[model samples]
Target: MSTQSVPVLAANDAASYLDLGITLALNNWPALTLAVQSNWGGPTSDDKRAWLCGAISEMLTERPETDAEDLEDVLIQVMNDEFDVVIDDESAAIVAVEIMEMKQHTDRGNFTEIQAMWEAYQLKSQQKSASAAMFKKVDAKDEDQETDDESDEEGEDVEMGDAPALVRAPREKAEPEIDDDGFTMVKKKR
Candidate 1:
């Protein structure tokens, strides 16, 4: 009899893999990415995204029977509650389906999709860093030009016209009066 080996993943290991897949799936989702990038969830948007990943992982782990529709509903609800965004582009459904597929693959100890997503993520990050560096160089040049222009303007004399002399209204000082108890009291002008 021919023997065949079947891959067996531990419970914790499977959960960890599923969590990673969920993170990568959320990262690639345009709606969620836009929300996080635009700070729609406020200054803690990044934290919110992390929290969402954990929440989704927990939901999937706790409810193994969760389907794409349920996942989609959760995604839409979260975007509305956390980011104040209503998704109407059906992107949430697509992401949900992808995540479900990821779950299936990870359950079988097949991480091809996860590995591919990680590589793509790395490439995207590198591109973003390069673009940011280019922008910084451009901004530095602009700042240097502004400083040079300011220094040149400093040597130029600005003409001022003579103005009329100002007259001040004289104020009458209130004299303090002594009360029956010998306490000094001053009355303010109405």
Candidate 2:
């Protein structure tokens, strides 16, 4: 006997899209913010548009049945009804395409793959942040080496170390690295 293949989303899934999208947005806020900041190399307006679109796209993908048009529809609804921000269909469509590209990177029903991808993304982002901090420390050391003759005298004025220009809020826990084969390895405390 042969069986017909059905789409992954059911009627319940359709009903859950909005709520699920909201949950996904809230839960992934940090990652989403990083994505928006890192991906934008454009003007403020364009970057906001792209960021909103990408967020909507990411939200819809969680429901399994949404597509590019649905992405635009959600964005339009949010902008007009929810936020009172006006946007035309053409602009929405452009934003939708940008986000849909992210979804198309993964196959359907392979959520583990998507999770691993995110783990890798988060891991690399943290690494970049660490290296940037290291470079800043080195730069600070370099700046300290310009000695002055008068400053060396006992009666001369002495200045304490300057406060860092870039302040980093401490992270609670480090993200585990995902292996090349898509497995996240956590370090267990012994």
lDDT of 2 by residue, 119-175 (tens): 565687689899999999998876665444435664966687888799799867878
> Model 1: how far is 7 from its true place, Å?
23
Q: Against the true structure, what is each candidate's TM-score?
A: 0.71, 0.34
Cα RMSD to the true fold for all candidates: 10.3, 26.0
Which candidate number would show the highest lDDT if scored against the true structure? 1
| Tens digits of per-residue lDDT for model 1, 90-165 | 9999999999999999889887777677678778888989999999999999999999999999979878777878
Model 2: lDDT to the true structure: 0.51
Identify the runs in model 2 with alpha carbons over 4 angstroms from their true place.
1-66, 73-108, 147-190
In model 2, state the lDDT of residue 136: 99
Whole-model Cα lDDT per candidate?
0.84, 0.51
What shift in Å separates residue 149 of candidate 2 from its native position after superposition?
7.6
